[model samples]
Target chain A: MDKSTKCALCPQKAVVHLKYFNRKLCKQHFSELTQDRIRKNISKNELVDKNNRVAVAVSGGKDSTTLLYSLANFAEKFPIELVGITIDEGIEGYRSESLKVVEKNYKKLGIEYKILRYENEVGKPMDEIVKKDQRLPCSYCGVFRRDLLNKAALEVDADKIATGHNLDDEVQSILMNYIRGDFSRLARTGTKTAADTGFVQRIKPLSVVPEKEIALYAMLNNFEVYWGECPYSHEAFRSEIRDTLNRWEERSPGTKYQIYNGAENLKELLKGAIGGAILFECEICGTPSPSVICKSCEMKKEVR
Target chain B: MDKSTKCALCPQKAVVHLKYFNRKLCKQHFSELTQDRIRKNISKNELVDKNNRVAVAVSGGKDSTTLLYSLANFAEKFPIELVGITIDEGIEGYRSESLKVVEKNYKKLGIEYKILRYENEVGKPMDEIVKKDQRLPCSYCGVFRRDLLNKAALEVDADKIATGHNLDDEVQSILMNYIRGDFSRLARTGTKTAADTGFVQRIKPLSVVPEKEIALYAMLNNFEVYWGECPYSHEAFRSEIRDTLNRWEERSPGTKYQIYNGAENLKELLKGAIGGAILFECEICGTPSPSVICKSCEMKKEVR
Candidate 1:
């Protein structure tokens, strides 16, 4: 925002100052740096490969929009095909608003995309489920969305399912699992590219980038990013963690990265000790799960 | 405070409501339950055995006061001799006020105890160090206090050193390490009975109980605990974490205990992977340390 401040790499006046990196950048270099990091995040983890078909879960949020755009840009020179998988959770105002942005962006990119609805795929619309279930909407929404995403990615034959989980989401889940004393959950919190039987490997190319950076990246590139809060809202504990982490990120700019990097290392160490994830096919739906029945089937049973 | 509410075990009116246990207890039953948990924590961990001389690090704060009193009370039936090890950081009014409570409680219990002054043992009073050094007093104070506790415990021929680290403190340290990505420190944060070479084993019997419970126990038993905050304060990140955790604790009553329990389990898992504590004697002073020289010596040298 400081026009007088020049870019750290170039003479162009800085458009955004990144506190975590302690650097200022112009529009040109900022995009270069962000995209470069995203590319590194993908290649380092081998989330995508030559001739591999990758399905990205794009919600039209700033994070997903940025990820889709970045991947699409990279795909121009690369041999990989990018498919956008957007889930219409049917949250009334929530899904309808973001759906427009998803369609528009996918159209501009001209990438093959699929739109999956909750009613068609998961047995119930989220709005109806909200009315019937006494539980918070997030608990059900997460299970359903993840279930739908995985299944849809498999249908399109995605070698890996790349998600738009930014660094904030990564750290928040890590801390939440820690708070819950669930080591197994904590171990699986990492953005692993490994796949088990009947499950598609999920990858996060934007896991290293901060949420703010994603917004800025979206803005500078003029991507159609939908900024909307869900009517049903977030998990309460998560909101607390997100706000606390934000304040902490402000207090010390790169604290989240440190925690996340440490978590990744710790997760590897835990997986070694706990023997990684011991997933099995759900008895009801044949989905890979820790328990006899997958959460998707369990929730569907509850709703029915 | 609810006089009409009957104790879960007895006819006496319940004085305390413990949400973690979801139980109401009378004055007598509450004491019994807390002390029972403390005793189990000690015995289960093998922190103290028959004929062991245990030196308790009593800060005269509610937590330490509760720990010392609990040990002293247990010593009546057990053969273990309880020695009170109090540290005077010499922070003007900070040590002066607490020192009185430490002495009074020690005398009342008729336990032989030793007081180690920071000036005598660590080569600097905290006040002078605070004035001379640019760093926060806490950074220096914690190292000095820990060092003095270890040395003083050794001099008293104590087999183990016990401290009043409650659940809140335990969970906070676990999270702080996680936040900082210091897995080594994270592994060492758990209450372990095993001591490294040339160091007295340290234990925390109060690790199971919450801070609020300790305060209630102190007040209910009329323990004469000192209530004061030092002019030189906590680490900034810790304060932020503590406040955030307090709010989280309110949001979900048993959350802190869950986190602490999970941390304890996770620490064990990490210790196995990381090969436990790798300590060496300080080259200069021959104290047990992870590095070539112990932190106490490093800090002592810095002050000099």
Candidate 2:
């Protein structure tokens, strides 16, 4: 019953009995456990390359924190270099809190980190856009975040941008896009978005772990993750999809895993089978888009 | 604009148009529009019978009420009796409100009505069974509804039971069932379920009308409708499908219609080619089922 007792899965539990938090897992297994999930997802997806430089998009949530921690560990052993990047969405409280955690975690890991503040780059903050449009906060946040993340990765000369999106998030997105007949987004939703050109390869290392597991891991590891809901997330259709899937998970355990596996199995067929030609390069930004322009540009104009 | 003036296509536009809540349509056109949808759907589908003693399951919702009203009108001039059977699911507030509308409409139309209440008939009320069981509400509701509807048709000496299900509901059910890999339901879901020994055929007259249009028609026609949401529907996954389709509709107005039509066109292949024996007669109930015992009986025993 001792709070300081060795964690159950810790190899040290068998000998020295050193406990980290309340878990019986030794520091080694605890580290390996988190790393194993990250590595397995990457290997299974064929996402990482030995010669590729990876830029980890760290938002300091459980997902991004765990992702950065694991990628840093993976880079120490692999032939790849891991660099951390953060996009300051300029949300007064949430982004600032998240950035503090990201920087603290990166400094602890001694990883090369870059922070791209939206105010400095986008010339307009998300708060202003959200207040003005009132129709789409995500329209602005998603576009700016993605653009900044990719731009940061390219600036650092990374060949791939590694995101902390877990299995539940990825599968929910796949299901959402598929349900909406958004074949273009559906085609690009897997762990590795293969056909995307003029953009660095995007990979999700935690694409197999469930949301609860990541939260638990982050908690057990004493990660300084900001436990707060995104203000704009309530209106997000993605949140609705998440809640919908979460409700399903409550009824049938491991449904999220099944959905993840189903999405993975579908990647091969969906790549070429959804035969519409929306995969043209954006003439302005050179990102994959259905039209001559990217969604970001379209949204910016649409919002204006 | 004179408020008393009716829109050219709608008769009771002054009263019913309020419920339709959308400005683009008038009362008569609303009803005609709903009927046109059903007719077009029925025409495109290879399942409706011009001479068969087709039964319509009257639930008293706007969709079913409209379906019953239209079916009565269509059958009056055609060679069909259009037997109207209502299954009482025994849900409080729901069945009663709907019954009022149904009974009133049936009385005005002088259509023969069959009401099968669940508790005295199905051995137990669904509300009671649901309290004891952890299975989904729809699971019990669907099973009890289907069996009772079939039994009602047989008792009334009819060939097919027609339900008020519309395009949006059908597509949602299809996607939900398909996602769960329920091939049997997929194979069975069409405009008309085929004939098997001891089992009455089933058809959907409102199969093409959208739920919104059905609501509009019900309001325009002075059919009393239950406007309250099902207390248990919050937990059902169909709403997610509906929302998904709605989002898709926002993106592309005709996607649901196209998808249903695609499935509608596949009816022949589903019946003749796919050839699932799951619809074979159940010895106990003399209904079509894969086993000698039907799903309802199996569930009943399991619950007990």
Candidate 3:
């Protein structure tokens, strides 16, 4: 982001410097590059194709907001139906505030959208759940929110559920599972998301895009986005990994990409063993799970 | 080590506290437990058994000396034939001094041993190779020594080549390759070593024991071991992993064991794809390699 540096693609002043590829870009070229990357990722992974309705999960955060805009443009350019799905976990000072940003974006973009709240969907909002459950808020909130999003997307008849999980998120998850030695939860097959049973095949169009670039994209475009951490969000394990990975990336750029590539290679190798892993229906909620009870249903049982 | 703490197994004063198992033991019981772990690991992994000739690669270091003793005691109890093999890399003052301690231990224990110097086996010793080669001494030294050990073990008609790789070494190697994303070399099958193409299978009897315990065992047993570091030894990546793993182990005990366990599970999953990987004989030295030329033969070519 040098003031005097020229864009790698043009003579305009470089506003964003991508350390991984050693590329500098101006506003226009940077937007184009970011959009092109997302478009290519979508097409390459077959995340969105002609006449397919994609439910883009937005959290009103920078990543999700940027993904909404990116996907909107992609929908216009290509022949795909687009819808926005936002889950309000009902955390105090967080969900209500961010919901406004998401609503504004949905209205402005003229996209069909649904906002599911934990209060209505799961009977207990995150604020209430946190006060009751001694466990970490994220432990159940994440599982609950993910389930709500998937169910909502499926209700809308969407063929795919695309999340705003950036490259940093993917790399952190890969390394996190690796460090914890949780091989079953590590990398597996089918592009980014391959679903069976009642699970909708999820996709990440912005998987290749780093989080910083998404923030920059949101800022450069002046998108109405709520850029704040959730009050109930305290994922200790993930935060540690995020800090370590960022420091490693600072010293060694493209380390994230290498990790992702390695995980993909590992997925192919693990494909056979994990590919046949069957999903069972939760006896309580009828959600596809590896056990008799889905995590969300278990959370619901605890809440009740 | 508590001043007045009683041994977990006996009334004697505790000398070593095993954090992983939360056990404290006296000098005698600690030795018994350490030996028990090694013996159990050997039997469980089937590293050594009755009537099989095993070559113990003794480098005169604490781990090797402890491993040598442990294996000898194991051999005596289990009816196995044991022979010591020492590789003299000729690292100036380092090797000559350590070789003396190894010879002393061999005579005291009445064990059959062979001291193979790099000068006689390969064209050049490590000291000379370090001077000529611009790469790290370990790059060539590791491959060359491994080849030499395999050949000597085969020459001695041994069933397996047992090395002094303790838990720390095993965990460090697992993390190093993992961090590097070198999955091909990460983890495979056959307990610790699965060999083909005239390659002697390798085994690590002390893979379950920590390095600190090895040092303590040597001290308690009063084994004649050369206590020093190799002047030519400086593994940057491994050192980094070692330091980080130590810090993690301090904060969260048994992190090392978890990593090792996770790797074993991963190995089982990866066994099918990697199990059939065929090793070919090097055209030059007729050693087993994935390529036409083995690493040792390639090094020989470079040396010549």
Number of the predicted model whose DockQ against the real structure is largest: 1
User: What CAPRI class is candidate 3?
Assistant: medium
lDDT of 1 by residue, A7-87 (tens): 988889898888887889999999988999988887787777799899989999998989898888878888899999999
Q: Chain B alone: TM-score in each candidate?
A: 0.93, 0.84, 0.95
Q: Is candidate 1 or candidate 3 better by lDDT?
A: 1
lDDT of 3 by residue, A126-196 (tens): 88888888998888988888899889998898998888889989888887677778766775422466555
In model 2, what is the error at residue B243, expressed in angstroms? 12
Q: Residue-wise lDDT of candidate 2 within A1-304, one digit each (tens)?
A: 5655555754356222212233456556755666787887777667887878889898888899888877777777778888899998778878877778788888998889898987776766677667777666776778878987988998899989999898778878866654554545555667877634657889888887777768877877788897876777645567666777776676656667666665455444344544455467778667667678877766656554
lDDT of 2 by residue, B91-124 (tens): 8887767788788878888888899987866677
- How should the candidates be ordered by lDDT, best one leading? 1, 3, 2
Residue-wise C-alpha lDDT for candidate 3, range B1-304, written one tens digit per residue: 4445889888998998888778888999999888998988988877766798989899999999998999888877788888999899988889989999999998888999887889988888888888888888888889989998988897898998889999999988887666667777875522467655367888888888899999999999999889878999888767766877886788678888888888877887787665545778789888868899988888888975
Chain A TM-score for each candidate, in the given order? 0.93, 0.83, 0.95
DockQ scores for all predicted structures: 0.74, 0.08, 0.54
Q: What TM value does model 1 have?
A: 0.93
Docking quality level of the chain pair in candidate 1: medium
DockQ (C-alpha) of model 3?
Answer: 0.54
TM-score for chain A, prediction 3: 0.95
